[model samples]
Target: MSEQGFKYSILASGSSGNCFYLESPEKKILVDAGLSGKKITSLLAEIDRKPEDLDAIFVTHEHKDHIHGVGVLARKYHLDIYANQETWQAMEGHLGKLDLDQKHIFQMGKTKTFGDLDIESFGVSHDAVAPQFYRFMKDNKSFVILTDTGYVSDRMAGIVENADAYLIESNHDIEILRSGAYPWSLKQRILSDLGHLSNEDGAETMIRTLGNRTKKIYLGHLSKENNIKELAHMTMVNQLAQADLAVGHDFKVYDTSPDQATPLTNI
Candidate 1:
């Protein structure tokens, strides 16, 4: 289906919660189920999909913001939940006793196939016990989603470079984070190697990894209180332009709003 159309939807993205739907006629997967069960169901309805339409739900980490609704969604929909072994362990408390029939655990650095989609998991620098990111492929089209990573590593870049569409985190502007109302301890955590990616760092990664095949870039996991969508867009646009890529005219750069369903679009 290389010549066939494939679609991906943000559904929702932000600090409050994050979830995405990726589909081809042969596969339908949800990257995460962070929002409430009702909210997730509503968002799926907006896209004309039902919870049962999902083939699997892949979790990036055990952060509450990313897995808040996982257990409920899984219990209600009985969807297969995929995660690295370590992540599954760390989240055992929240997940309680997962139904083996619906729990599909894999090790990091391994590739798993679901229908027409092939997914590869890679370790990312984040504070979670076993944080990871995902690279998804179907019909020769590839997309990488790496939110919550503190920084981009050489190995991580190798995985991201192959993606035609990259959805990476641009969590905050350093200036705002430094001067924001967050306390000293919290501030240090955000700036740490195991914290979150800064806006400038995210742009630098884009400048280095983006090639002609890259058509869309989504800045995800933004801080509602510390960062502005315009600022995040401008930061990436300016950096990419220096590399000779225009913003909207050359490619799409979308801000995943803090609490709204972004319409699904073809990559």
Candidate 2:
């Protein structure tokens, strides 16, 4: 890693909760804070970070699993919260009372700089009022955090191309999801263009966006009941191989867990 590189960790990611910690030379922020405030604080502690050290929280959507802890963390730490106007309105009722100064809204598709890092939000296909994903750039390096989307449009794929690192969704395996214990309606929701991405779709998105600059790829947002880490990992590896890409030599794949944090990695 270079002196000006970016670093990040998946504090937790899944259907249960989804949060990520990212930092540039002059900034430290959470992409989302989906767990309980206490739990998120504990996870940050494991990485030797303190809540008081954070700059802000950037939300992907208003879903409970994606914004559960946003209000608590903001009130406790006096941190700023960034989201599109639509997402802010949808999540406001559930986030409790927040100080006006703590709320910051960013326009979709526009880049905003917190410090050394420049982040751009783009729309994603999800059930929320206005779901979004982000691309963070610093010192010519890019890191993308894209999850909770049913399908990646070609435009979105182009926006994230050549990222140095990625934490993208690989929610479930098609066969397992089809035969899993979930109700048929629920399965359809997960398979819809407005729902979550299946493992196969996630792999294809990776193959489309991957480039020479890509170094690490973290498969995230797995379903505990319908998918397992090994299955998601193997699915990605096999699909990438079919695209003439090697997992290790070309880029390493990592699995994110709902209960733990991935090692802080440089991008």
Candidate 3:
């Protein structure tokens, strides 16, 4: 990867599971490990990386699809795992045994430095106990990973604004979800403030958060049943057009997948 900026890839992203690989000049890390250990291992190989190459695993929440393989990877690779105190408490049972030094607790809304990168976690409106999203900075470039939140509050937007790249969730099409096969209670939950962002919600967030510094946007954590890549991309395109922004020229948008990894991108 280029030494000028950060290199990253979405290993897998969807309701089934989500994992992201990020490499700085001095550190290689996994933002989440939601897939099986075997699956995550294979995905890392696709990017010419191995589990042992990772310096740490920073978890966003305790959701199964976001943490299924965290324990396994940490144990197998002897990698450090970092999360907020409440998230540690909620996910401890799922992680099994670990050396005392393997676990690192960080406070919310605080920036922690590892090597050349600075990472900050802030609260998000999600059902999981103390769920949060992350913003990572390396020198002048910044990247934000915002997902699993039903709505983006002004505070959250302010925190993540002007990032060079974003991996934000454009989870579902509201109409399709509203009229789909899911039960009413489930639909209600998905649409609630503590759930996931709809396509429209995601677009609005981009409009508010994108700035002169923003360039690449990855729409992730899509719903397999209620969303398709084309539809989600179109929604973002249309909404962004209304703001006088051109998709390919103003900024590039990439759709992430659950079954595969995006090419390693530099920002």
Highest-lDDT candidate: 3
Task: List model 2 lDDT by residue over 175-203, tens digit each.
Answer: 99999899999999999988998889999
User: Could you tell me the lDDT of residue 186 within candidate 2?
Assistant: 92
> Candidate 2: deviation at residue 232, Å?
0.3
Task: Report the C-alpha displacement of residue 253, candidate 3, in angstroms.
Answer: 0.8
**Which 10 residues in a row give candidate 1 its minimum summed lDDT?**
1-10
- Relative to the unseen true structure, what is the C-alpha lDDT of residue 94 in candidate 1, on a scale of 0 to 100? 88
Q: Put the candidates in lDDT order, highest first.
A: 3, 2, 1
What clash count goes with each model?
A: 0, 0, 0
TM-score of each: 0.95, 0.98, 0.98
TM-score of model number 1: 0.95
Please estimate how well model 1 matches the true structure, expressed as its whole-model Cα lDDT.
0.83
**Tens digit per residue, CA lDDT, model 1, 1-267:** 454547888878888999988888887888888888889889888888888777778998999888887888888777889888888888869875568898878778988877777789999988998888888877677888988877898888987784678887899999999889999998888889899888888888887777777888999999887788999989988887777776577567877865676777776
List pairs with backbone clashes in candidate 3. none
Give the range where candidate 3 is weakest over 10 consecutive residues by summed lDDT: 1-10
User: Against the true structure, candidate 2 has what lDDT?
Assistant: 0.92
lDDT by residue (tens digit), candidate 3, 75-143: 999999999999999999999998999999978899998888989889999899999889999878999
